[model samples]
Target chain A: MKNNSLPTDVEPAKTDPRIKLITAKIKKENYKPDALIEILHTAQNAYGYLPMNVLKFITKALHLPPSRVYSTVTFYHFFSLKSKGEHTCLVCTGTACYVKGAQLILNEIEKQFSLKPGQVSADNKLGVSVARCIGACGLAPAVVLDEEVHAKVSSEEIVNSINAKIAV
Target chain B: MPKISVTIDDKKLDVDVGKTILEVCKENGIEILTMCHLKGLTDVGACRLCLVEIEGVNKLLSACTTKIAANMIIRTKTEKIKRYQRITSELFFAERNHVCSVCVANGKCDLQKLGYKTEMNHIRYPYLFPECNVDTSHPWYVLDHNRCIMCTRCVRACGEVEGAHNWNVMNRGYQVRIISDFDTPWGESVTCTSCGKCVHACPTGAIWPKAIVQGQLEKKPEIIGELVEKRKMNL
Candidate 1:
């Protein structure tokens, strides 16, 4: 593939020294091909979801096509294309979990939060999604609160769990 | 050639410098289980099964792609490595529509063998019964999307090895999938070489010859290694 020389669609960073510092550090690391995912993670941690500037800066630094970068960003689920809330709740809807009533639990969560799957609650405290099995089937009907798994749960149990998290 | 001394599974061996731990282990008959790694392809390191602890490296590095250094200490079968491998294999089983008994690749699938080898009797994770379409559109092959592991070996083989650029991954994360170019159906994709390379490259029964659907769903051809090598030369 030819190296892309065209200007990128992602916006350039604002004149913040912190941004400059981060970019400088990334540049110094030399952005090896294998480090692409890690770089995206670091970029998101620093700039929240990959905004135009971060994407453009990454493109310019890596000398990669902007579309190629964007496609990669879209390929991996770990990379978020949009901003996330303070807390995200992922309900496992994999077969084992589903057989154990994962959907019912998810419905209860959505009802209590007044939102649908993959939506952020009105209060912005929780973001909900129905995930594929997260490899915790031993704990079927598992709900991931942030990154922690609460296993072998029921709809009522999930409601209580969310209420507890919200209270804290 | 420079030599690097590394300890794996407590056995000390000196290996030629610059080879990945995987190449060394394979050459030395030290088995560290892995999938998503076909020799000589770009190591995407998607499967975390080959992770091993390297002294001074905090995170586990993939043996398939990480180059060896002089005097490196590595542990391949530590409790942590075993646990992670089991978890990743369990996840693989849970995420896809792997009903082995009904599937054509039941006896010959690598995932099935891995499950047996890992002693995973039951899926601890929930099963994902994602709705899938089985495409028997191609004249010579059947594309069963449901059985796909999404390793993209076929896509890589088609694009990088075959020079057809016919296959590409579409979507992200769990939703990520292999697609023929232009969102066209497998039967309709214009770029496909009809070389049957992707079908043969598949690890599961996701792609197989159409005529042999019932009795002919066979293990991937062992010739894939040579095919990959030949394609590299041609490319």
Candidate 2:
């Protein structure tokens, strides 16, 4: 396909075994037009993020409009259009977490790995993002790695955990 | 269809069935404030300016999309409704960089009139100050994302009325944007007809002709309904 300079990242997504799994999922849904949301979830699972090519492929495969697919991905916070590294790190920036020095943790992680909010590290080992009040106000400053939430996290603890993931 | 009696601001009237509260309000000479409720387009209930308090319903419902129920005791103007209207208008202003003083729509903007009707002297919320784009790729018009309120009127106008399907929304709350043709420049659109329907569809100065400048914009959104009405005539 001829490239049209899409807004997403330049690095093309790899054609791995995940495409077959995604195809099977789409087939399982019988290509229902209303199954867009569920198909998008499957696409995200197949690709770490909903890359532009993956979105286009799904649009054609399911016979859905491109705008419908694009708008849905953009409307939901959980769906990402950009690449997320192998390991994801999220810092709670909710009012409660901010007062508890969540900024320090974000800053420390950024400085240590040279990562910014919503960016996958060049090494593709870690990605940094911020959350607003993850409902862990009691924990004050909380950090989420992959799926587990760490409460009352300090600057040093965040740096070490990221390093531990990076080391892997 | 059955006609039912309803009271709007203490005035008793018999309204037809299947019509929305907004349509009935308009028919009865009652004024209801609106921004995203353009004619000839499907209502997505994007703007909350026309929220009316019903006697039975606990929550304020949007008048544009909600069908009038039988015996509906509708209140278009109340102390609480006015307060919410003022706040919603203020939030619309503060959500983006709406520099009315230097805008192309200037005094001719609907958003400005909404502010005046709500008596909004100042916005209580802090300005979002999002870094929006100015897409002047089209030869005639420009899409200024800064002044956009995400009402989706342009998106509907182009797709539903114009049959272009060029303008599409991208992203979620607060960070959402109206993109033209796969998020590319508008000038490069493969589907746009350059009809300027989206320009007329916009409530603010978000979409306008490049031939005009500040305070020079003149739009007639009412023409959308007129066009739809004329098409139905088949004369």
The candidate maximizing DockQ is: 2
Q: List, residue by residue over B5-93, the lDDT tens digit for candidate 1.
A: 88988899989987889989999999989778875456777788899999898999998889988888989888898888888889988
Interface RMSD of 1: 8.3
Model 2 C-alpha lDDT per residue in residues B1-235, reported as the tens digit of each score: 6889999999999989899999999898999999999988898888998999999789999999999888889998999999999999999988899998879998888999999999999899999998888988899999998899889999998888787788889876787889875576888876789998999999999999998877678898878888888888987
Best by lDDT: 2
Q: What's the i-RMS of each model?
A: 8.3, 4.7
* Candidate 1 Cα misplacement greater than 4 A, ranges: A1-168, B228-235
DockQ of each: 0.08, 0.28
Model 1's lDDT to the true fold? 0.75
DockQ for candidate 1, C-alpha atoms:
0.08
lDDT of 2 by residue, A47-90 (tens): 67887877777777887656767778878888987778789998
lDDT of 2: 0.85
* Lowest-sum lDDT 10-residue window in model 1 chain B: B213-222
Badly placed stretches (over 4 Å) of model 2 are A1-16, A89-119, A129-168, B214-216, B230-235
lDDT values of the candidates?
0.75, 0.85
